[model samples]
Target: MVTRRDLIRWLAAVPLFASIWPLLRLDDARAAQTPRRVRPGEPGWPTPSDWARLKQQVDGYLIRPESPLELCRESPDNAECLALFRELKNPYFIGDSPVLTQTCEWVGAWRAEPSAYVVAARRVEHVAAAVNFARERNLRVVVRGGGHSYLGTSNAPGSLMIWTRAMNEIRNHDAFVPSGCDGVIPPGPAVSVGAGAIWMHTYEAVTGGVGRYVQGGGCGTVGVAGLIQGGGFGTHSKQFGIASASLLEAEVVTADGAVRVVNARREPDLFWALKGGGGGTFGVVSRLTLRTHELPAVFGLVSCAVVARSDVAYERLLGRFVAFYADSLCNRHWGELATLLPGKRLRIDMSFQGLGKEEVATLWKPFWDWIGLQDDLTMMAAPSIVAGPGRLRWDGTARARFVPGLVVFDDRPGAPDANFFWASNLAEAGHVIHGFDSLWLPAAMLARERQPELVDALMGATRYWLVELHFQKGLAGAPADVIAAGLQTPVNPVVAESFALAIVASEGPPAFDGLTGHEPDVSKAQRDAKLIGLAINELGKVATAGGAYVAESSYFQKDWQAAYWGANYARLLSIKQRYDPHGVFFVRHGVGSEDWSDDGFTRMADSD
Candidate 1:
């Protein structure tokens, strides 16, 4: 019944009415904005009462920064703390705390500090409770097994750390039955170890106590969970298989705080992901069941050092070593640590399982003959063969009494530490030294030598360069189908076809002067590391074009996804998304980690 002019006047006021609606609603919203419930220490941080309640819920103690424990007392220079730090089995706890000067010296090359709290979980329920508490508080959780992550992903700033070293129980089974196996037990001689157990302790328990062995890392301090999850490789890897291949079952705590037993017959997808997918990405592994091997009574050991006079001579010598290593006998473990000092010295160490000294000598006859022809090279000593435990010795130290998986370096207190940057690459059997026409070419120029410009570039950058090679050909000998099947996991696919792993490393002093009050810059450290890494990568490009070893790779790799996981990255990403939809777990250069940047802080990739 209103006039047309009146209707037009009302329409003009419609825009003004709409603008005022939000203000009226905002007034109501203000009344509803109640303060969040907080504890006593800080407005939002957990208080003493909250910590006390959490302690009652778990079997283990919740250690606050102010706790009177030897590791965390009021006095930073407490003598008890120093003593405890030295004997602590877990390396991560040694140097990770910002307040404590005691650090695990093994990882001095790559050290980082974790901000906030550390939870030393004793039982499965403790881990679950910690996870739930972190989720409820909206705090990020970082899992530290042995604290051996090369990229220092195990510890982060402002994260709730779940330290698993206290859960170090190992149970041996003659005929083990995996969980969810429907009453079907696998073969005999298996060991179930707590995820936090160090490899040295496990090795001693199974090998020294039961006369059984498991293929694990050479360094005994490596955590069982970290090694097995990241594709463990040791001196015996070529004889049996990688550490991941020996996994029978595991108990995992997922992001949902559900404790699930994963194996081949149960939770198959998670099982596949846990093996070689890298640790701290899928879930927290509480326990690991692994197949053990019979220990050999005795084995043959060979040790020698060769000196090269010139760069050309060094190249030829290196090529001969590679060629011989490619076709060498099986069940033989050999390592070459080459350095540019004293012109060039290549340390050759080998151990032959289930073989006598005479047989080992015969096996090495080809290499000995090859060494005799070089005029500029000299074998410092005859390749001596002795009968003893097949322990992989580091540097040129005298072989210690075989303790069956005892880590030679880490067990010692106050071991020398160095800051270094390293990169790794895998070379297929056919591609190793293929450009060389003959093994006996003493003065022949090789690919590396042909590019004099590259050599000049390398010499100009650093004082010393080191190349460490480990020959692992077990997977390569397997049928293609078997290799393909194994590659379905998160392990680097290049390992299946690689005849040798080449690790190129460079060492230098700290960039800044500590005495002059010059603080360390994270960006500058990363930049220096990248330059050294690039030089090493360039030197071994042709020899290791297939892929790179994740454990020893450069931290600043540009094509990290392809270099680490190869074709299996997409599947890994899918699995990561399905299990950890909220991105609960993360490791540097790990699967699905491409979305994140490499700053000292842990942040989402999108934020960068």
Candidate 2:
């Protein structure tokens, strides 16, 4: 739980803005603006007076109550601040904290308050100003880039958000790679990338033009900052290691508001902490310069979704998926499974980079043969090797029915009742659908039948099908060493890679069926997540008894220093203390406070 005092302390650590005019004096500029229309059931259609009141709360921070507009002149070069001043005066712009209103409903949701979001310069100076202002005023600061966090930590009630959507610029220095680095000649092909740059955007810039590219997220929409900072896992991870391993340098604005560039060469501790330390911890990153490589655009990304006939079928599927992934590892392709769907469908999505379609087929033949899908499956290859930078449009209401133990990497089958509750178990991967016949499948089929373009887009650029294995008390015997090696090992072939498993579902209205049978599922289905905690305690009894414990998906509250920091926990704390001693960056979802004297850290403090 991120306590209020912790947040306050974080704010204190930030470097104050240079003696520019206070941000508060800009209120009078919008004193006479009229509010817009209000509609029923609209998420953001506050009434005129409601808008007025909300705007008042927002302006109260920027204006000195008695006199507004006096602060606008302080920083004449601040385009974002000036643009915000103009946009706020408009009737359409309503100021509401996205945290309370939307974050709880959907993890990836964002409100487009024209004046609410600001993308400061790539340089640290602009970041310092934004951080200092938010800290001085005690405004909760939610940082946004890619908006992919499953926890919805990027937005807060009554908080100001710094949206990094506009920071998508990518600059490549052809002489930064080790091969290109001679004693005098700097290094071979290095790229200084913007935090907001998404995987697809970076891919296009790198591979579309030159043959060179760096490791990025599998999902195109995932941004470089969040994904890399979190120790990104992808198909490429098996060959090149996780994305963070490729990081060379990062220009960041610490909690104290001072900008610092940390790398292996300078500020090594900060550099070490940045790799897999997770985002929103020590500072706000503006730019990340990573190592690059040359690769093909039309390489093979293999996928196999196998259907199971019964519990025994599921066991075979698990064994085959693990064995195949292990075998593929020797060949430089990584393997992973999604366990925890209600039914029994064992599907494997594999990626073989730098290989053509024929090569891809040959590499995946053994796995297909093992699953006995060599004849039953139909392989639909996309026309182009690359896709995206497109828009995101979901049907107004979309729901995900997920099981808790699905993220575990170990090959475990479902206990009698696994899908009944919201028990999140410690596993290696996130939710995996049992069969394509689930709700999401029909939806996809409908989309394919109705919107072929959307279907084409999915097939061409993304892993369209997701198959997960549910790790339960009993499913199969222990995974062999060859399989485990591929499951946990890292590679450094073409791009940096890593794996992440998360349980994502919609917090819908009362009418939605996604949450149906919540209580019954837990009682009847052996679906209590707390049991996992018990199992962790009884680790020896289960595994030594011939079961295996997967390590990828451990669940811990942010305050639980052990769970949050993992192996790198100690270094992360030291970095936090050194960089954010004043505590300006505290209000984020996971970051702890600098001052721990008043109250102990606990999950209860995180609740309303």
Candidate 3:
């Protein structure tokens, strides 16, 4: 698409000596350039003419996104600033903006910053063009879809961002056979979603529109692509399986600007890597197709909280709950989370499929009866159960009547009625994360022989901080077929051997760094981080596994390669070198990320 005049204009933007590139070979010319990624105002940064050319190539979709927080400093009391602060509380409003990440800050680690240029990509060609441009110019490349990374991997300053927010497209296929898999891989029901499509929207199209289910993240606003890459878990994961295991195929743009259709049959190794291999590591995934399953007959939830009057009572309650869970709720019908609180209390927010209200109530009667007999226990909040048609669980309007504030609607004018997030997830919206730690608890911990020690550890952890056990993140008691299928993914093998993942995390509302009166309290953050680590250590006393969920684990995780992927790290690194050898794409904690400097601008020498 470039004319001689355009080529001359681009060449003019370069240093005068670069006009001699015609005399040298392409490979020789490349060797003459520096490998360091450039930032604005730095040497060899893209010129105005170069940027203009890129903008034209992308159909004028490029933009310089700025943070709204800047306006708060400019006019703190103005209507716009006040409105923006209010909108910050809504996840959808935060996601629509390119500069604002869901997480505002991460303790002493990182803060949300605006990139210098954003390619608001609406198609695969746009993404490829942006990637090629960044590679050619030695510019740091950042990609974001949902902008929900707790580690803040999606946003960076003075970089070229391939913002995929505008590419939210969803399509359904009754019998989708991946490219080159016809006659070899049988057709299956599937849904193809653009990189920017969030779970809430995808659920509406695949579950609400059609009577089928797609395993996705429990949080409604989480982006589908990122979750798939991180081994997604949801309320019904006990029955279906992890989200990445359900991926049938993907359309990706590799570092070389090649658009590849990867699946189990075509580019098999790359497809295997895409299954929980980590996003933005191998390439920029343009669209993904995931297998779907038949909808269950019923879906339900159990919400309640209980407190203990004495430490002895708390220990006894823990013992009782552990025994109760193993005996009644250890099967595939149950999922979601339950928290052990610091005040010797327990908060239950569990969900299930195919169980009716009265049925689940009967199953919990023995546990409640045992609690009623205790002299030192008190009921903080009585159990309230909601059971309904499974098809209606994801229907925003239908779920609105289940329990008040259970889900918050996105009431922005002209927004889709299906756009809403779980009220429990509201705290994470534009929040500043203090600390997060998680690890798998092997199924053996639930055995009668180990119940006492497990109870001791559980009670001990509550003393420092709340601990949430997400049963959906582990697939030990799942159906044999489900476990076999889920194990094929690149996630840690321990996920299938464990009964649950114990997570301890904390965060506060948006507090951007260096912003006076609104900056994160470094002392408080460090203190809470220590407590969170201490809480996790208590569980580690019983569970010695290094494996943790990549999406929700510690940012400073020691041996992250082993912790995130276990034995799968080696293979993932091999694939990364094969496809992105020069490292055109980079994100902190992503595979092969250790080969680059912390800022991802400098390539290290110790890479394999």
Best by lDDT: 3
lDDT of 1 by residue, 102-211 (tens): 22211224344444676788888888888777666656667887666655566665667787878889999898878767567556789999978877667767875677
Model 2 CA deviation exceeding 4 Å by range: 1-123, 177-186, 296-298, 329-331, 335-341, 354-560, 587-608
Give the count of colliding residue pairs in each prediction.
Answer: 4, 56, 0
lDDT of 2 by residue, 1-608 (tens): 99644544555455563232233223322322321211233445334564344334433222111112224346533665455334322211211222121112221222222123343334445556667655554444557666545444544434445655556788878766432224633676767788766675576566654557577665444568987776665445544545666787788877767777777667878766666566766678888988776563444324444555565555555454444433443233333334333345544434344456665666556665555553333323222121111111000111012222312121124421111111122110121111111101111112223334322322221122222322111111213332232222121111111122222111221110132221112221122333333333322221121111111232223233443343345556667667765445543223354232111111122111
Between prediction 2 and prediction 3, the one with superior lDDT is 3
RMSD in order of candidates: 10.7, 17.4, 6.7
Score each candidate by Cα lDDT.
0.59, 0.42, 0.87
Off by over 4 Å in 1: 1-44, 66-111, 183-185, 329-342, 389-464, 477-485, 507-531, 543-546, 595-608
Model 2 accuracy (lDDT, Cα): 0.42
Worst 10 residues of 2 by lDDT: 390-399
| TM-scores, each model vs. reference | 0.73, 0.54, 0.94
Candidate 3: residue 57 Cα off by (Å): 1.2
Clashes of 3: 0
| Model 3 residue 484 CA deviation in Å | 1.2
TM-score of 2: 0.54
Candidate 1 residue 286 Cα shift, in angstroms, is 0.6
Decreasing TM-score order of the candidates? 3, 1, 2
Q: Show pairs that collide, candidate 1.
A: 94-103, 95-103, 95-104, 595-605
Candidate 2 Cα RMSD after full superposition onto the native fold (Å): 17.4
